[model samples]
Target chain A: MTTASAEKTAENGAGEEGYNFAYLDEQTKRMIRRCILKAVAVPGYQVPFGGREMPLPYGWGTGGMQVTASIIGHDDTLKVIDQGADDTTNAVNIRRFFARTAAVDTTEVTAEASIVQTRHRVPEDPMTEGQILVYQVPQPEPLRKLEPREIECRKMHAYKEYGLMQVSLYEDIARFGEIATSYSYPVMVNDRYLMSPTPIPKFDNPKMHDFPALQLFGAGREKRIYAIPPFTKVKSLDFDDHPFEVQQWEENCALCGAEDTFLDEVILDDRGGKMYVCSDSHYCARRRAEGHRGTLSDSAAAAYAAAVGAADRPSEDGESAEWVT
Target chain B: MAAMATLAGSAPGGIDTTDLKPGLADPVHDSQRVFRALLEAMARPGRPLQLEEGLDPPFPLDPATAAAVLTLCDHDTPLWIDWIADTPPVRAYFSFHCGCPLVERSQQAAFGLVSDAENMPRLGLFAQGLDKYPDRSATLVLQVPSLSEGLAVQLSGPGIDGRETLRAAGLPDWFWNDWRLNAAQFPLGVDIIMTSGRALVGLPRSIAAEG
Candidate 1:
């Protein structure tokens, strides 16, 4: 759909010549490319850039979209996921957005994609050197909580100051007995620039350090873009007594019976009935296809089918899945 | 991550200013260029930089300097302010234009506006990068009261060939002494910018103060 329109725009001989390959205009792409180059040069350094407004909202993966849009060309394959599910509405919409704008090929398999825009979790599969991961950061400043002022933070960055961050962590331990921030925690990138991993779980934080893929962050409403180039080091802010830890689940996935994947706990009934499922849809599906089965696969499938049936049944306003479980 | 679908919905490179938010309508492009100039100024210290046109704010901050912050800061980057000039209009302008969060404490800011040099906090209170890596220093955007002929001080440091004197205004002697100590930290000191309307001067982390 996007290909047709892009071709139409091209055929119409839009604006000046030497514009960018897609519609990003050469200067914009050049600026983004320059930032990417700097990010690559200084791995894990959050090189700030002038972020532009996309035809989308702020929180909904605009950063990843911008990075992807800047890097993508007609030949590249794109993959987008949200909560590890490609079929999820946001993922589908983002995929559609890129398809329409850049006119690039879209894929679901992680390995095949040249660029992947992700929210929450990194893929279970290992990322390669060629790929780039663009994260959607809600907040980019790590010292934001410790120091609220941009002027102060800039002074901090300029002066190489970070004592307050340590003080805040110590206070957190003194009060809560643990660092209260569960996800989207601050990690020092390349031991220099402070970066926000965009609310991805702690499980994904380790994956960020020493990763082969180039990592980029964009916060549209905030108008900031930072990056972690390939091979950069990333470390979660922690102390000797308080080591960084991923979320641990006592039970295996109810769908794929996998113990390693992140699990989503579901309450089956008011009487403490419960089930757990692998949050990575692709991984879960692959496991099920490979003869892996869990205690509730059959029942869950039935329940899902019943829910779909109920939705398909026309109601007063023709709404479907309005109240999803 | 998924690749973009196609090239259909991509808007033109530049949006119409009339269509843009009032704060953002006219300045995105020029703001970007000027911000780049500021970055370049820091990347190589002591270099005088020129700003693009179309930026003018009220007293306290020079237009070019204000333009630099407007380009980089948003509601996300908090400002540590030393003094308040037209509070309502300034706040409204920043919120509407840049959407930058304002911070009262100097230590917590990403950028700071030091209106009064006499009342400026100790430089050590701001961020200095950690031991292993030290480029984490802060960037100070100082608005000096005046920049006149022969009102200068000598500078010496990494970026300078030798002793170089440049004119500046409204900074205390303690500020320079502290800056020298800050520069002794090498890759861990703050960068400074002193500006009037169209003209501006920079002192990157590399510059050391000389008597």
Candidate 2:
């Protein structure tokens, strides 16, 4: 139904050239908006929506893009990030798409953006009130892996029967001596529903609890949208003895020297050479700008700085240098 | 002059057609703003939101309801209104601006508009959707006397930090009883948007309402 209308609107020249404003018709936006309302009303409850197919593929942040397109306005400054980096290929493409379709301003700075669309990681920077965070979810249902059938999953949610999930955690502990799940960790929102916080590492899970910004999760492939309102309760699922824990490293970011941020282990060569750097590009840049230095060598630091500068500058054809590479 | 004469000639009970002119001035921006307010109201249940744009519908329709219908109702949404708000002018106004189809049965309605909260239909009358697709349930937009300074109801649920007290005037005593039952239904009950003057308070089905 959406594709037919999109084609019709494209032929009619409703929006910029062929595409509609933000690439969705007003009716689709209304439908998604109603779904969003219900999702927010029942926090962590996944609401089924008529998820529309974007120009991009489903797994590549299509759901988050749809949510952002629906709520974003001309005045909103949009920030798109992949694995907490603004210069990643997926993030750059999404940012450019919205910038062209909606004609909205785009920014890399977390504090300046009114809407932040992310995949895999939430920014280390705390979001203030009125700012919205849209998460691109591949799987909205946390129990889908355990129970593949949708009917059974719905019944389980209705009955609050989370024994399967608990059993899975127990099995993981029995095998690995600890909870094996790392990213996409399940959380109980408002102490009612068990929700999947996407693929964001378990390290970023604590940031979700009592968050000031409204967090929206959209899964295009799963055809679901869920929400965590501002200051809402979010607890990561765990047993009493096996409490939830985040990944920790002995070294700080190679460029920023930040001890708190989630670090990514980058392999410089095929040999045993590896360095720990901040997964959040913006956080790392801000720290570097503040004159923070790590144990990185002078040549390696200079190369990193050059790469960051090149990524920030848009080429003459309006594409970021990161895209070409 | 001709259009005005024709409109007046077709008027029911000699009611002035000129006075029944209240709709969104700017459809795009105005609807967006109203939707944002509604989103906030739903996310934070039992919290009162002062709608920035004041709408002037006929006598019975309040500003908040007017804004809600304008923003939410469209061609896709099937709206059902009570007899009090099912007047010709109100119907015509919504039809012209929103293009929403009016449904005869309340159960078929995706969105419902109620002018009289005290004598409104039972909660079970509207669509509760199915268990698999609970979001298919109806959203009720009810008009009350006042949003504040009335009977205090304790609300605790997904949105509330702990517990919050809400006072809404001109509601029947049985409303709380019905709300408790509705909340028990979990993902299968209708959500409510209460409008009084230019303020709105959302009471989603997830909220546990106690007197």
Candidate 3:
């Protein structure tokens, strides 16, 4: 049989012979594929699905992984990040899994990747039309607080019954001087459906509007998936009296000296030594390559390399087998 | 429309357990099918849903709806039972089947299941949705002994263009009164589904309770 026919045969069956490509069955992929098309058509609308269990836990990046697995093909280049760092433990593990199963090419640069699975931050590079950003969402509902029932939420979406959401925001203005939401601020997608940008800082909210890339939000535990297609209109919810604003810290990324990037506060030692760093690891790495270095990067990288090198080293007998835990 | 393709045969008509997706074990697959049917019934208010099989549930709740609770609830989901009205067998079965913990009060439950609506707690007891995003609300599953045609309540809302009435037997008079107040909490109040041994009817928060 030709290679193409063999590949097609494997695609029709789950884990047939030697393939478990991404560990999801083709039927499940077909289901997710259907959901994606509907999401793209409705743009910014949430569609409920029978989300399956992965080998990984729910809180971890399972949702994003599922989305990646569904859309990832032989030709795709994948990139995964946690807290914006590609080398972070969770990110490393996910990338390694994809490499083993799907044998897809991996990239560290944002612009080079066709599919990027991310948590917490959007990349500094403006995404082009061909790229897809899959977000790991813990909570997918924008109106979960008002109507706990999935049945009710469906009705609200059908009729555009959203008065209760308005009341909650008005209350926020009443209590705080402004809308107190910083991270995970709710936004209206395409002026038709309300969506959560998956806990990305409000700084990323504006970037969501009319973006060139397709954005997919998956909340596995919540059993919901939502999307924002290329050039879709997204507006953060706010009143005329108090407009929406992104959260800004007084300090810049100490390493990059960049004020526009979202900063992650790193506490050094017990003395409460505070330093701000760019949350996006690629952005931070680029800054360092340009001769910008934070106080902690050198120490952190040295410790990390030593630990990994030791873990990878061969034993005295030259046998590569790792000891049982 | 593509998303609805796989779900078409299973939606309005109750799912056949034998025809379920391969590799799914009993209870999980059956419950999933029933839950989807229930969700569809609730999505379209005043519509009655069919049960493919009898549930033979422990006590207080029927087998069909029990299957729904088992499929939907988990450790992450919060469940509220009628005040001291639900039986021990029912509670134990839910804990075993769904792994869901009991809520101390009605307001806290993601799902509120009531066996008796006559002496039911106030509708205000359930959590209401906030103003900014009103979708966060509780789902109430009320178990009535029988379903009939007389003295039913009319439902008209997002899914229903004209008035539609559903007969749910064995409910208290004050139930509608409490539901009236619950409807006022639209985006904030609870969504209710009244179930008998074989039939189901939904009352979304969007519906206005007739006086």
True contacts kept of each: 0.00, 0.49, 0.00
lDDT string, candidate 2, A1-325, tens digits: 0011111223322335666677887788888989999898778889988899899888999999999988877667888889988777788788877777776667778998889999999998989877899999999989999999998999888778898999999999999999989999999987778999999999999999989888999999988999998878899999999999999999988887999999989777789899998999888877877889899985788786566553234331225444321
lDDT by residue (B62-117, candidate 2, tens digit) is 88899998888888899999998888888777776677898989999999999998
| Winner by lDDT | 2
Model 3 agreement with the true structure over B1-211: per-residue lDDT tens digits: 2355455633223322222222213542354345445544553567677777556675566654565566556766688888644555566656655557887788788788887766777777787655433444566787777666546777665444456677777777777887787766454567777777767776666566574
- Among all windows of ten consecutive residues in candidate 3 chain A, which has the lowest summed lDDT? A1-10
Q: Ten consecutive residues with minimal summed lDDT in candidate 2 chain B?
A: B9-18
Ranking by DockQ: 2, 1, 3
**TM-score, every prediction:** 0.56, 0.89, 0.54
Residue-level error in angstroms, candidate 3, position A300: 9.6
Residue B120's lDDT in candidate 3: 74
- lDDT by residue for model 3 (A1-325), tens: 0012112233432223464566676556545644553354344567666698987899787888888877775566777778776656677667666665666666667888888999877887788866888999898877887789987977777667778888888888889867778888888875667777888889889998877777887888987776775656789988888889887888877666777888888665689888787878677667766876555576664453244322212211112123232
DockQ pick, better of 2 and 3: 2
Cα lDDT tens digits for candidate 1, B98-131: 5567776767776677767667778887766554
